[model samples]
Target: MGKVKKTRKNTYNYNVDRKKLRRRAKKKSAPRIQCDEIRNAWNRSKSLAGNMAEMGLVADPNKSLPIRERTVIGEPSKVRKPYVLEGLKAAASLPSKQTMGISSDMIMYVRHMVENYGEDYKAMARDEQNYYQDTPKQIMRKVNLYKHHHTKEYQTLLASRTKQ
Candidate 1:
């Protein structure tokens, strides 16, 4: 057989070492004159006199300037009353009503069916606690929802029943 070519493993540092060395070599070989001029120009522009020149303002050499207090144009001195607190108070005064999910009575009915009848959906449908008169399928669906929501409780109930 002919000599097989070796393959390198893919990694973050693959070929990075050689590229870093090449970059270092290139940087060392480059002239520093232009870099030094650019750095000096940057330092000059960052000075106080340079800043005043950029802003079209002249600095007075004879007298020291006084620091002026910054004033906000439209802000009021007094704190305003929050309207959100009033809305929250209004909401708190009203009685709360359950708008989503099954009612507490429905939950109690499902729990009764599960505890008394177990998985016997037909028996659950005929149960007096099932005031809605849910069909076998509807009873099964409600039982499933109850099981999903109260898994730990359902398991404990089953364990207690088995123990009895």
Candidate 2:
């Protein structure tokens, strides 16, 4: 004869109230004081005639205070001075692109490389304009530098190329 298998009895209560359990699990915090209550307390303290008030340290809250007129200080004098031509005029006249270390020739070279090789740095190195005899790595660096400095122009170039 085969041995009989024993059945396990269920211990968990299926009728337990989940809402009551959740309520019991929630953390209780102290009620916060309102800002108006704090302000009223401050006003009450200030209104009292204390030793600090007698010493003229704390101003009387009941007394009307003067409205301080805003005055401008350390402002430049309006007197006109003689016009001086500093070397800054030359720098100011130059184009924003010229301010970057990458020259126009280098930009043109990079543009040409991209237009022809389409990011093939080794092929770009073999191109006729690789007059500097820059290796593939050096050419890639120059291209990346150009792209970084002139992002908008590079984006436009790509967009135009895609349209073609």
User: Best TM-score goes to which candidate?
Assistant: 2
lDDT of 1 by residue, 1-164 (tens): 99999999977767568978988998886534343223333333255444333333223433223355543221233213234234446766777675346667767887777778777888878877776788999988877777776788778776766676
Cα lDDT listed for each candidate: 0.60, 0.63
The regions of model 2 sitting more than 4 angstroms off are 1-100
Clashing pairs for predicted structure model 2, backbone only: none
Put down candidate 2 lDDT per residue, 112-147, tens digits, no spaces. Answer: 888877778999889999999999999989989998
| True lDDT of residue 69, candidate 1 | 54
Candidate 1 has what TM-score?
Answer: 0.37
Instruction: Supply every candidate's count of residue pairs whose N, Cα or C atoms clash at under 3 angstroms.
Output: 0, 0
